[model samples]
Structure formats: C-alpha cells, structure tokens
Target: MSVLFFDIGATLADVSVAADGSLTFHPRPRVVEVLDSFAQVRKGIISNPGPGATARENAAAALEAAFGGRFSDEALVHWGAKDRRGIFDGAVTSAGPGAGDCVFVGEDPDERVFAREAGMRTAAHPVFTLAAVEGRPVFWARIEAPDDRSPAELEAVAKLDEVVPVHVASDRLVLAMATARGVRAVEQSGFTADLRGQVGETSAFLVRDDRPVAVPVAFAQASAAFRATAEATMRAAAAFAFVSAELSGSRPPVSSLGPGPGGVYIAAAAGVPVEDVHIPGARPGHIERLLPDPALLSRPGQARAERFVTAFAPGAPSQETVDAVRAAVTPPALRAHVARISGAGPLVDGDPLTVRSRDASSADNERVVDALAGRLHELGLEVRRHEFTWRGHRLSNVEAELAAEASDAVVLVTAHLDSTGAEGEFFDSAGRSRPYDPAVDPAPGADDDGSGTAAVMATAECLSSMVASGRTPARSVRFVLFNAEEQGLVGSKAYARAAAAAGDAIAGVLQMDMIAGFQGGTRTMEIHAGSVVPGPVAGASDALADLVAQAGPAVAPDFTVQQLTGAADPAVGRSDHASFHERGWAAVAVSENFFDDTGPATGTRQYHRPGDTLLDRDHDTDYAASIARTVAVAALTLAGL
Candidate 1:
C-alpha cells in the first residue's frame, strides 16, 4: 500500500497555539480538498510542533479538530524536527520496506531535500501531490511581460493548468512554481524567466515589482522586477532579487539574499545584475522579502521622508548633550564589543568559536547570552535571563535592567542576538560552501545583528558609566539582547507576551538592526517608526521616531537621518520593535539606508549569510557608532537623563 506524509505549519495551515495547550490552525487555500482527494492513499505527518513537553499533544489536538477522522493512525503520525534526514528515514522505515513508494508533501525545499534523501518523492505545495506521486520535477518560475507590454496581457497565466501563480506580483509580473508542462505553457505565452534548477538551492527571494516606472532605467527596472519577485517570495515561492548595494543605479547588480524592510526575502553571481526576465515593458528595481510573512503584509513601506507631503522637525537637543552621548559610544569601543561577541575573539573566557551561528538549534546560543551577562555584571548592572523554548530547544532573552529612583515607566533598547547563515541563500555545489546544513552551518552574523548587538552593548556600557557618575534617569532603562531572533523574533515575541500578561508599562523601544553596514551616499540612516495610516498607536510611534531623528543633528552630524513613518516605514512589523508595537507600546527601528534608492545606496549585501563575520570589510565601525549614539541619546533623553 502506498503511504504519504504531510508537513504542517505553513505547508498545511497557518497555526496558532493557545497558552492552555490548545492548537488552532487555519487550513491554507486547498488543504482540505487536497487531503480529501488522497483518501485512497494512507496519510501521515512529519511536522515540527511548538516548544514544550505538550507540543505534540497540541498539534495532535489541532489536527484532529481540523480534520476529524482523516489522520486516524496514531502510528503513522511522526512529530519531530525535519531539519535533518533522520526524521524522514524513520518515517520511511515505519511505512514498511518500499521507501520509494512513499511521498512527502511539504513547503520548505530544505525539508524536501531530507525526504528525498530518505528515498521519498517531494512536493512543495499540497496542490502538487499528484506530481510528487507521479515523479515529476516541479519548478518555481517568475513570468513577466516586456516593458512595452501592459500587465493585463498576462492575465491568462491565472487560467493555466499545472502552473500555480502563488503571488500576484503586478499586472505584468506573476511568480509561480510549476511542473515541466506548466513551464512549457508559460514559455509558450512569451514570458520565459526560469531560475536555476530546483528549490533547495535557494530558500526564498526578495522580489521588487512596481509599475513601468521612469528611469534610472538601469536600477529602477531591476528594482521593479525584483519587487514582483519579492511579492512572489512573500507568498512562499522563491525567485531572484538583488541586494540594495548592487542596484546602485551606477553599479552592476550584485546577487545576494538579504531580508528587506518588506521582509520571504533572496542570491549568486558577483557584479552580474540580477537576471531581469521580461517580455515587454521592464522597469528596474530590486526584489526583496522576509519568508512569506502574513504579518508583514500590513507593515509599513520603507520610503524616504521626502515621500510624505507633511513632516515634523526633530527635537532640538544641545550639541553638547549630543556630544556627551556620542563620546559614550565610540567606534573603537563598538568594534571591540562586536569583535568579542561576533566570533572574532573568544566570547568571555570559556566560549571559543568553532562556528558562531546563534540559530535556536545551536548550543552556542546560551554561551553568547552568558558572555553578554558577564559584561553587564562587570558594570554592576542587574542581569536576568528570560528563558523560553523553540523547536524543542531552550533559548534565553538576555537583559540588563537599570532601575530609576522613582518611575513606573521603562524604556527598552533592544536587538536580536540569534543569527542564520543558511536562510534565503544559495551556494552552487561546485563552489566553496558545502550545501548549508543548518545542523552545521556557520552564521557569524556580525553585521546582520552583531552590529546591532554591539550597539546595544555600547549603549548599556555608556549609560552604566553615566549612572555610576550619578546622572540617573528618572525612567528605568532595560538593555535587551533577544535570542532566536532569526527564528521569526521568537524571544522578543515571548517577552512581549509575558509583559502583556503582567501589564508592564513599557514607554518605548529603540531597535538597532544592521547599523555597521555603510556602503555610501549622504550616510543616510532610516528610522522605521512603524505605520500611522491605520495603526492604533501611530501618534506615539511617530513621536518615538522623531526622538531618534532629532539625535542625528546632535550626535551624527556626519550622517543624515531620514525619519519614515506612516504607510512607508519598511520595517513595519518585520523587526523586534514590532513586538512592543503590537502591545500598544511606542517603538521604532533604526538601521542603515535600505530606502532612498535615488541617493548613494547604503547597506550590507552579506545580510543573513555566513559572510556577516568580523573579517568582512562590509562593516563600518564609524557608521555603527553614529547609529548607536543616535539610539543611545534618544533612549537617554526619553529616560529623563
């Protein structure tokens, strides 16, 4: 008898787990129809449940509630991490002798690779189970009309069989994954842009698509094309997108996967412009994403301040005051802290680096937290660890709180500490990187977050010195380094959840992400103040952003801080600050220039990759200091220092 295994979460449904071990999952598009169609074939599960001892029970309860009597065999339902081949191997073994007779239907290509290794055929979407059973290779393709053609001409793409248009990039561009026959059909329609073979090579892409916009045709069209790709990727179909630095109107596109302010996010050739496939009128831009995040769909955009018709001037703090904050967070000090934590040197005494990936799965995660705690202890600060579980691993959100003489409100300076080298990246088998196995991948995320981590550390170090000198702020300040941030802000989310449960009054949060990357331009910095258009606490978020921008003139005179809020704030809910924002707490994200495409583009192409190490020249300590100082000054000012 033929048996089948299905992956849960994004593959089957969008999931939610209540505090009481109850699971609520909404089936994705055709999940029910597809599962019912395969009634003759025996179905089993190979899925990763939430952390804690009752995770399996929660998943089973949700499964049974959603599709009662569908998955009856308790023996076939295997719940475990699918990051490796062992789980698939066990599933195959349990299914009896003929492994080739079984098929696994899941979303992630990496998971598919493991199943393939277990001698089972794989399908990305449940809709493609027939193809998986029939042994047909499925391809994810981006089809777009020429710059000269209208987007409406490709409407028939939605009508095609075998080709699934997962994301509607634009009227002209559509991102879809299909079988060989579907690819042929799309090519016959006169729109042919085929990515490299298979999905496992690249996790996802940053697609940038807009109208057939005006010049600089060089970069605008590229950016537009990628925007569409980013949308497709946001829907979980990966395609090609360019890093911000490469699409500098003057420079050739450099292909490297990095999360954009928009968040599924993109990779390979150096200096080769991202393959811009179009049949008609093509506009140039870059494709960007965070892995198909529904939460980010309503998040704000990342345009420059100039995009808005109205504006507010920053608070005028004394230059001397700015200088005091700047003096506290120096380039050398920031670099030293970054070097210590980011695998350049030993993290404190006992922690040496074999690899520096703080991915939730890595044991090194705890060591990094302990190292940060050690530094805080040296400054005589109160350190605490809020431990949480994720993917069956124990992780902690490290914190160092400074008490106020008398105040009920608290200000938080935060950054995510976890890193990943494998997500949204591609390395040819012939090239150096031996297919990135998360179990052994190297994610020395020096810039992806080591920069932000260093900034947060420096902020604490400086503030601690001030407090030692008797300049205590009225409001308490908490310096937080979040763990497993790369795993969808797991630590921050937990913190937010607990704080909400306790009714903690958090005034505001200043989140600094990739501050060390300084490519060029007016040294412009972006203040992501969340969105104001329809958000509940837009007014509070706006004020918080203004505080950050006001710091630019005082501390970072050499750098220009373009404050963006309202509809266009790119980081909307993609960063850690979003956690607090969801709780109605005022918050903002500070980072390098990922917006302002017309200006000298700035930011790291090595985002989220193993290349985010201390050895890379992409990190600019001076720029990092400026950003750190900006955030530090704002936090201090808010705390009534």
Candidate 2:
C-alpha cells in the first residue's frame, strides 16, 4: 500500500471570514473526499514555524479543526530554514514511518522540490498570497440600510448627471458609492456628481465605454472622527470579489476578491451617483497583464526529431566517437558473422536475442548456457564454471576474468549474460522458434548484457594492455562476465556472498546491465548511489558521476544522479546492487535512463528476444569505451590508486 503525505495549511484548509468579520477555518471537502477514498493512504501535515511554540499550537489547533482530527502534534513538521535539506530532514524524521511508500503534497515550490529530492513524487497546490495595486477607494451602500447610514455616507454622494469633481490629493479620492444601481443621492456636500464620471481602476477601467450608470454621495464635514469611520466603512465594502472574468479564464466571477493590510484592494468597480454596478471577480491591476497561450502537442515527426536531436545533442562524446561506436556494434561484418553463426542466417529470418535468467532447473537453459559459455571463450576470457543440482536439474553460473591479482582491493564490474525473448518469428533466422517467442536457443542477447559484455571485454582489453605495459594496477580490478544475472541477480548475489565470506575488501561495485542501441544516439545514464552506503561510499559515487559528466558525451544539465540515501525502495531492488547492499556494502547501477524513454509499463522489449542482434540499431562503441574508461578511472581513484 502506498502512503501519501499531505501538507495542511494550503492543501486541506483555507482561511475565511464569518458573518461577524471574525476569522474562521474553511476546509475543502473535495480534497478530504479524495483522501477518504484511499484505504491504503495516510495523511500528514507540514508547515513552517510561526512565532513560538504558542503560535505553533494555535496553528495546529486551526489545522486540526479543519481536518477533523487528521492532524496530530507529531504530524506537524516545521523547519527553521524552509529549504530542501531542511524540509527533507524535518519531514523524513517526523513522517519517517512511511518513507518508502509516500508522496508529498504542498504549495511552496521549495517544498515540492525538496519532496522530489527526497525521492517522493510531488503535487503542487495553488496557495494564495498577497498582491498590491494602486487605486481610489470605492464604497457601496444598499437601500436596505437607510437611517442607519452615518454622516460619512453623505460626504462623497453623487447623482446621475450631477457634476461632482474633486482634486486628486495624496493619490486617493475618498468617495462613497452604492451597492445597488439607480439609488437617488441627496448630496449634502458642495461638489456635484458628474454622470460622465469615470469608474474603473487607475489604468484598467474602460470608463469611456463602461461608464457607471449610478453613484450616490452625501456631503459630510472632513473631521478626524468622520474620516476614520468613512475609511473603515469603505474598506469593509471593498471585500467583495470584482475580478475581470475575461482575465480569469474558466474561473468563477467575483464581486471583490478580498482585502489585506495596507489598503491592498481587491479589484472592484467605482460608484457613480444614481447606482453602483459592480463587475464580479475583477481583481485590481489584472487587465494590464496577459496570460500565455496554452501549450500545443508536438507532431509525430517533431517528437521523433526532438528525441533524435536530443540523443546526439552536443555535449558528451564527440560525434566522430559516437559514430565510431555505432559502427563497431552494428558493423556489417559482425552482423553477417552473427547471422552465419546463428545458422538461421541473417536476423531478418532469425529471432531477436531473448534475455532471461537461466533458471538452472530448466533443461533448455543449461544447453543455452553451454553454448553461451562457448561463445564467451571464443571471445577470449578465461571462464570459471559452477554447477548446482536444483530440483533434479543443473543450474550453472559462469564467471570469466580478464585480469587477476591478490592482496589488492577488488573492484568488481559485472553484468548478467542473459536475455528475455518475446518477439515473433519475424525476428527468427530460420523456423527454429516459438510463437510470440519469449526465448530461443542461443539468443543474440545483444543489448541485454551482450552490449555490456562486449564493452566489458573491450574494457578488459584496455586494462590488460595497461597491465602488460608494466603498469600494475595500484588496486586489483576484476571484470566478471556474470551468468544468471537476468534471473534475479543470482550470480551477482552468489558472488557478493563469496566476497563477504572471504572478507574481501570491495572498495565499490559498478554494474552495467544494458548500455547500447537507440536511434540517433540519444544517450542517458542513471547514476545510482545506494542509500545504505557509508559516507565515503556515497561521496565516491557522487564523485564518479561528476567525472562521467566531465569526461563523457554531452550530458544534459538536468541529467539525474539519484542518491538512494534516505530509504530503500523498489528502485534499489530492481538491480544487482541489492545483494551487496544487503550485506552492508556499497554498490550502484549505471544504466541508460530507460524510465524517461519507454513508459514504465513495457520494459525494454528486445531484452531476451532473438532479434536482440547487434544489427537491430546503431550502437555507440565509442560511448561504450568512454564508459569503460570512466569506470576504470573511478575504480582507480576510489581504490586510492
């Protein structure tokens, strides 16, 4: 069950005024309904600190009253600095119980940003804030309040066609207007009302075209007491919603939005003598600004072009190197070679490489393992084989080493040599396949880990050459071609177990699962730094990510570097790092950003299919090599070389 965390102030409750001009809490029922619908959901509040604990208590009380007991003392979170780390530390520690299955809600941009950083999805709310505008005070009076009206009401009264004019003094014309239209004004003041008098905001009102039909005023002496009462009464009448409906598309009309401290008036229409006509929902200064146009969806070709351009977007590996890498992976010769080797002859007739974990107990998987082992040896790494009896069948995990050393801290880089086969015979070479084939014998397994394996092999060659040139690695590096990784990180887990048992000081582990093949080289890498790693390990992970950005292809500035340091979740379990992390070690996966590309629903489909041949798409061997070099440098640095 997923847990949801909601912020109280702006999310659930709103501030309102009662009939007596007293402050009150108004809760949004729709929001509460959504919360009530979820059986697996929990709610909480996050608020900023107020004056002192007393202020906090009062705020909490208001929140609780609005939410009907959803909020508690523990649910209220406060931070001195309202920034990312501050927000995260406060929320995580207070609402720490549901970290793994939680999403946070808030209105502040900083709070939403912090929630995302803490590895939670965020929903932003539209909370109200204060806005200022310049305008004259417009008052309103209904015929219902007759004798009750005070002398201040007689001060600025105007009748239709009554020429009432006053000099603008101190930027404000204190005038009273009626709420109803066509009210007769018995002007007691000397100034007469002009029927042609303008009645819009300082700069927004269309007075020439939208002149008020009526405005009434009564003359009153300008005394200190009279001035105060008149000002207060006018302010009270200004509280109605008067927003420009045209400005607020699809929003409801208002008489006057609201008023705040400092003569901050909500937009409203001015009054003329006969009667006052107020346009609803017109906020002050709203007409001067125009809203941006709505966004349009991209055309099909445009989207493709965007993806293509972004893939090769300048930054990262040079175009020449990127092209070179592609040529190596899908070379015509290699394509022909794989076609001839598979015998289905040419992938057009063969199945896509199927990626899957060797279930060990599956008879067919063992045969495939033997064949894959032959292929590995043909490629030149010394293979280490282990076979176990499980359910009356043999399950094998093969490990091959390119370089070996003892007494040196081990840097293990590995990938599973498996595939998922799900495409059709269109991907099959010959008739040797299944319908909607999920797996086939000797699946090319190109991208699954095949690309990874080749990259590893290529990297191994680079390291081997460096070692042979009399440059012994300050730290021993072992590139293990792990079998059965596709089957739940079994091989990596087994390897991690052995390392732990042997008391091997593993400086760090970097796993590359799938790292090749996309149109136009749209390359993205997700740097995963484990949550449970010690300070040093996390620092190393972050440093390595920075190095990759600095040395590899043009990486996007917004490229993701996830620090899984707060809590463990599904993301951490989806790769080989789980095994190592389980044993209190530091491990992280560096792979293409698949999430942003394909929707999460369908995973990389070519995974275990026979069509997982190298010819499937352009491969970036240069990028692969750069990755090799980057990891090599990172390992060297991490191991103190």
Candidate 3:
C-alpha cells in the first residue's frame, strides 16, 4: 500500500486575500469528494509555512480547519521549505511507508523536484495522485461498430434487468424436438450436460422470432465462455433466447472480455449487433513480425563498453564545461530568448507573439520564424531554410549546421517553433469537451515549444562558445527549428523526406517538444523511440536513449530519465521526430514524461492553453535548463567532441 502526501495551498484548500487585507481559507472545489475517493489510502500534509510567525500560524490554522479531523497532527509537516529533501523524508517516515511507496501531490514544480529527489513520486493534482495510487494507465481505447437494430428491439434489450433461462439449440431439428417435448423434457435432456448446476434452469426453446437471450450466468463467466466457443462451428449452432425478462436491477458487464474463439456470444450478451470489441489504449492494426529483431543492435561490444566508460568515467565534461553550459542556459537567458521569439514581453503586455497556424501565408508566423533564423545567425552559424510543400501548404524549416573537421556524419538537434490554440474542442478537468474562442484564447505555448526553442538557442550559444575556444567536434551538429509542427509535423516531414531522398549520412536526431513546464510531480523526462522504425534506426534510438540516461546524472545530476518504447498513445507520433522515424532515420524524442497521458506522469495541465506562459506559476525555467544540460552533453558525446 502507498502513502499519499498533499500540499495545502492551492492543492487542498484555497487561500483568498480580500482588499481589506484579510485572509480567508476555504476548501478547494470537490475537496471532500477527492479525499473520500482515497479513503483507503493513508494521507498526510507536507506544506511550507508562510513567512513570519503570524503567517505560519494562519497557514497552520487554515489547514487545521480544513483537514484537522481527517488527518493526524503527526502527519503534517508545516515548518521547513519544500526544496529541502529532509522535509519529505520526515513525511515519508511519519506516513510509515517506504520512500518508493510514498507519493507527494503539490502545485509547485520546485516542491515536486525536491520530493522526487527525496525518493518519492509526485503529482500536480490530487486527481492525478489518486490515479497514481490506483496505477491507471494514461490512455484508453474502444472498438465499436454501427448499430442497425430496430428502435423497438433496442428498447426491449435495454429493458433487460434479471437473469433469464436460456435454451441452446444445435439446429432447427433440435429446437423442434425440444419444443415438442415441452420445458420438462428440455431441462432433462443431455444437451446441457456440461452446464448442469452451473445454469439455474432451462425454461423454453427460443423460436426464430423471439427476443435475444439474456444468459443467467454471471457476466464474467458468460463472457469467458463466449470467447471460448467463438470459432467452433458446433458451438455457433447453439442458439440462445431469453425465457424470463425483467426491467430493473440488472448489472452491466465489465468492459473487456478478452480475445477468444470469435463469434456471436458477445453480440448476444451485449444486446447489440456485435461489430468489434473496444480496447483502450491499444493500437489498431495488423501485427507484422520483424525478423532479425532490432534488439541485436543494442548489445554492447567490449570496445563499445570501454568507450562508454571513458566518455562518462569521471569529469568527462569537466567543471569548466559544466559551468559554461549552466551559465549559458540560465533561466534569465532562456527567459530573454522566450520573450524574443514570443514577442510578448514588457513592451507587448502579454498578447501572443504570433498566430502560428498551419497556413504558410500568415506573415506573423513567418516573422516569428525569421526572428529565430536571425538568432541562429547571431550564434555564428550560417543559417539555411529548407522550403517544401506539404498537403498544398508551403512550409519552411530553419537549419544551422556546425561542421566538423573530418567527419561527414551529422547529429541533428530539432525543436518545433509553432504554437496551437484551441482550434478544436478540448477536454476540461472534468473530462467534459468544450470549445474555446481561439481569438480571445491564444495559446501562449511558452512551455510547449517555446521552452524547447529557448533550450535549443541556449545550447547553440554554449556550443558556439566551446567551438570558438577550439573545441571542434569530429561529427557535424545541425540545429533545426521546424515550422508547422502544430499542423501535423508538416515541415519536419518534408525536411526528413528531402534528406532521405538526398541520402544524407545522418548519425542521429534528437527532437525536443514541451521541455519547460514542470508542475511538481515526478521529475521525469521521457525519451520516446519508435520500435517499429527500421532496425538500424531503432538500434540507434536505443543507443541514444542510453546515452541520454547516462548524461542526466553526469550533466544535470538532478533529473531522472525514463525511456518509453513503442508508447501506446497515438500522440507519441504527433511530434517532429516522427518525421525522421517515417524515413527510417535514427531519431528519438526528448520530452517531459507528463506529455504521456497514459500514466501518472501525464504532464502540465497548462499544455496548449493560454496559461502556458513564462509565469513562474506554470513554467519552470530551471527544469528546462536541466534538460538542456543533459541534451548538450548527449549531443557533444554523439558528435565525438
């Protein structure tokens, strides 16, 4: 069992300050419902006290008023700052659960980082905390087919409420013989020999024009048996019809019935024409076997193992290099870069920088692209724009390559620089689909791609400085900012296709999307690699993932890296790296684990919303910088610097 720790402010209770300087504390919406939902789990609070004695007293008082009766005082840790891991350690000890089995839910990203460092899992919301405790996957899927039954028949099926006796018939002759003998003879017949005592009774033989059978057996058993005899021709001849019918107190069957023999059992049981069984989070397609599996390539040779050891052995990046990269990717520097690209700074007063829709004709979008290109030029690299047409829309991708002294292989680092608004309906916190006014609600996209863009810029600056100081790599490094990614990876797809057509010797591709927003849970970064990609490419992707995992501790030392292979969600292929995967290029996407909705790591709630701005409340530049550090080290390692 897991122990759950919650932060007070904005997490459990809402704090309000009136104009009159009075502070009011109230429970957050559905606080009681949320708490009641997790009644079985052990709970505690780990909140930092507000500044000063009076403020701390007020905070403690507020918590006491809200949750005093439910939680013990021993479970609350309201004194030290959250950044200190000791506070969480104490909470874990107080909760009497191992650090690995304890989870912390807090609104602040820094708090989450500290919690993770303390060996606890974190979540941004209480709902997500519940999901984490319950171990729910991020995505769900269902198979469905068109309903063609008459309204009357559908209504009659819907009115089913109780278990009804069913008669199984092998053929019309069997039915006729049973009908002639009446219900008594039918119950005594050997037809139900295997089903004796299992089924309550046999009351009637279903005719050709009768209501569908409602099996008296438990749904679990009936579903299992349906799958068992699905493909048996003899079993298929066993027709069933309801003998008794009621309208109330019937329980619906569980959703998943699992694959079995395949036939009419499900259709009869579900009270609908069987079309297809729905499987949540499952990819719909025919499974194709790949011979000489890609896993062979991931095996380490003696030489490769030695090389890995030498690369990360000790002080590989050196203290000076670490400081330089850290200084270059500072939050202040990244903030300035974000402001430059977004065009929303002190001068603009928070309006969106540009409407980067799919259309290439939008001058504002073009201007943002041009601004990024200009910044790349300032980094002492010659910028090139790859222009191509995708689905009738003209798109352009910006590239700036840092050539090596003697190698032709290229290491491509990419990030999309486009933003998406609420163009279509999106689900809200309550899982309700709602439409937003895009004109009034422009997607700031600061954390979505802006964080990635800024990280790339910061990386370019660091690499340029290193190159200027005579640290020339053996392999070329290509920095690319893709456009129209929000429009289904149009730009990157065209670029990858062009590269493949040109037969460029590319070593690997690292694509970044939504790196900044860290709404305090597990400080996890996910590396997404497509297993279905060509063998060499897939192997390279695995190698890169290993390198990244190693680089985190060596370079960033604070963030944890998680590798996800063949991620089930379709959205995994929604980014720019997918273009390279399609062309059989070695590529892996680096993103916050939160982007994967199938797990508790499902990232920031501010994604693609107007709230995805540079505000400290939502965005964490330090977290983004940590990711940049890891990427830089991984890139330099791949470049053989």
| Candidate whose TM-score is highest | 1
Count of residue pairs whose backbone atoms collide, per candidate: 49, 86, 16
| Whole-model lDDT values for every prediction | 0.65, 0.40, 0.54
In what order do the candidates fall by lDDT, top score first?
1, 3, 2
* Model 3 Cα lDDT, one tens digit per residue, 1-641: 78888876555654433222234445543456667777766778876544477666666666667666566545555465665678888877776635347888764445766777777876545545554465432111111112342222321221221111111111111111111112223333222211111110111111111112244444445566473344233322321111112111252221211121111122112122111121223221111101111011111122332333334332254555666676677888788777665545631235444443312334455566666677788788867766543222334577888888788578888888776554335666899986554334456577778888888888888889988887888889989888766544656755664464344677778888878878786677878775443334455566667777777886666677778765343334557776665445566788876655456754556765666677747578778878877787777777776
Better of 2 and 3 by lDDT: 3
Q: For each candidate, C-alpha RMSD in Å? A: 11.4, 27.2, 27.0
lDDT of each residue in 445-490, candidate 1, tens digit only: 8887888998988888888888777678888999888876665566
Model 2 per-residue lDDT at 344: 26
Off by over 4 Å in 1: 1-315, 318-323, 349-355, 423-434, 595-600
Question: Whose lDDT is greatest here?
Answer: 1
Looking at candidate 1, the ten consecutive residues that score lowest on lDDT are 300-309
